[model samples]
Target: MQSPFDEPGRIFSNKRPLEEDYTPDTILCRDEEIDRYSEALQDVIEGFGPNNVFIYGQTGNGKTVVTRVMMDHLQNETHKHDVDLTILEVNCNKHDSIFNVLLELVNQLRDPDDQVKDQGPTKGYLWNTLYDELDRLGGDVLVVLDEVDMLGHDNDKLLYDFPRARKNGDLENARIGVIGISNNHMFKDELDPRVKSTLCESEIFFSPYDATQLSEILDHYAGLVFKDSVLEDGVIPLCAAKAAQEQGDAREALDLLETAGNIARKENADTVTEDHVERASDRVEEQRVLTIVRDQLTSQMKLALLATTFLNIDESAEPRAKNIYQVYKNICKTCGYEPRSKRRLNDFLDSIRLYGLLERDERNLGRAGGRSYIHTLEVEPELVFEGLEYDSDGDDSVLNQAGIVPSPEDTDQYSLESFGA
Candidate 1:
């Protein structure tokens, strides 16, 4: 008997290019963004100083990759001109607070053996240590904060202070600049006015890639990762079109293609075909929806979503805001939790809509003098049920108490009428 790991995979010649962290040497379909990013960093290469840059884009649109490419070019040019440059980077998702961010920066500056512990230090001490490190390095230093929005409104003091550190007497020798990259386009606006002005001296936005752009990018990566003629003619196009229709996310497209290849390899197929792509896409989308519903939403938001899902399954039509609110209140009561105000429930709906989990439409009332919003589940109702069920830890689910189960085949199992809707 031969083990599965005995032979090399036949589908993917190289899988590194499909990895999330992999950065290609050439970035296609982002020439304009690259040019803008280059201009933002040109000041650093010229020896004047680094400019604070703010970049905003949705996930998988190449914001981080473009920044890395630009930084590499900046380093080469600065070296040629003999300009002293130091670059520090951290993802604010892990180090979410001001103190943790400062600590991460301090640790990055220190030698591996001399790192400071996360505990037993005031934020002020950490700031001083960071300033001291900067002054010692004593050149132009660029601090790149990726997912900076994760710091939230309370922890944004670093954004305000980092750019102005030199002039504010925090450091006498080092000139500091900050580059904040966020997936939330509204994050910059939510910052304090003072922080916003200093950190956004230069701003760039990366738009989602259209189908044509995603196809080009997929072709480029396919050429690098797959053996010649291994991909069927329609595989790349199907993957690109599917991703474009959803979020125009290049990462999703790449994941789809990679999963398709893996599926083909598992089946001992010589070429990846459109059928594999379709199956891969379904799997990817289901996982994505589950992750968002389970991990990303708050308890109240989950209740609201559960309400919407129930209505969607029962009525087979989009539920209005009032209908959803009524159902949500009933579910909250069944679960022994207090319901939020109607206004707050609307906010939850909007937030869910922003996540692309729900689709909302406005119905204008010609003679009624007002409009009503209707919402439909953007994902399959069964996926929502599974997410909520897992979130509640299986059989003891709040959904179960509310008479909502994952049986889509029998819609008669539950109804809003039972909830007094």
Candidate 2:
């Protein structure tokens, strides 16, 4: 009477509910935040101009979720109060530049069959058209720009102009409210004073969750995700501690728990355990680094990292910019790709270093010599090497001929991933 499909284990009752996009039925530990945000949005009901709110916080800090919750409330209350309200939400990351952003707005507000061009009329024309459409609707309209910093320099004009459409005589009716949300802490400081005063009429800051808060959030989702008697008591605490120490990121804590459950489930274990969490952490971090490098970095940057990894695998070596550059040149030559200038290579190294995947230290040789920056892989070399394979030209003979991949007899024993101090 054994079930063939039972070997995957019963650790997960529901997986989707525990995902990052899952919105919980109950939002805990944010009653004060919810109330404050709701109060700010209440202007729609009072016939007054909607308050332009700027929300700033770290990633996974409940900013998006809380905003969605308030938007739901605003939608319902506006309907009940017989007020005309149109809520438009756009993630600035998806539409970074001003032209693209305006195009998105035009598409969203205009007739579906009457789509706009990629680089249609001037952005001012699109803006005026958008204002005309909103005025035709005749109600209070709120535009929420999430990851507002992604707008970069263009955000100045977008922010400075949105709230003042009526005052500036661009619209005959319909008051516009701008809500800009961002994760960049320095974004506000870089903003023009005029933009800061206009867009940041009401500001709300969401602080990172502590261990206790993350623990509660984790336990809540875990209970819904797993069946009874499927997880050890210590599992949640361990995951919570790891995520809290890192950044108090609830999403990370949830991911850790979910990954541990998956690991234990794959092994057909009766319950998730601490050991699974430990292994899951390593895999998650490795995958995070791999995904970042393989997808985000350019070919030259990959070569730079590959060079660093090659030197890193040798214990008796110092990986410097010069060494990395030489290796990068060799790689480019092998792959039939043109090599960039040394200055450009330095720019690539700067980007890699800033990415937090590599650690660099400046050491002064002596009064007779200038300082040199030594580079080391913060990520494990094995992960980097494996990730670099995805960047390979997809031909083994070429790699072997180019001396990029060492033969078995070249070393006593070696693994591309193994590294020394």
Clashing pairs in model 2, backbone N/Cα/C closer than 3 A: 382-417
TM-score of each: 0.75, 0.74
| Model 2 agreement with the true structure over 56-153: per-residue lDDT tens digits | 87767889988987888788888898888888888775676677777887788888789878754987788877877888887788999987876655
Considering every candidate listed, which one attains the maximal TM-score? Answer: 1
Candidate 1 on 1-421: residue-level lDDT in tens?
7686625658778888876678789999999998888898888888999999999988789999988888888899999999999999988755766888899999999999999998799998999899998899899999999878766666667889889998888899999999999877877876889999999999999999999999999999999999889999999999999999988889889988988998898888899999999889878888778877776666677889988887887755448898899989988888788988886687567657767899888898567737888798898887887777765344455656555555545545667776767
Lowest lDDT sum, 10 consecutive residues, model 2, at 412-421
Q: What is the C-alpha RMSD of each candidate to the true structure, in Å?
A: 6.0, 7.1
C-alpha-based local distance difference test score of model 1: 0.84
Clashing pairs in 1: none
Regions of candidate 2 where Cα sits further than 4 Å from its true position: 1-9, 290-421
Off by over 4 Å in 1: 1-9, 290-421
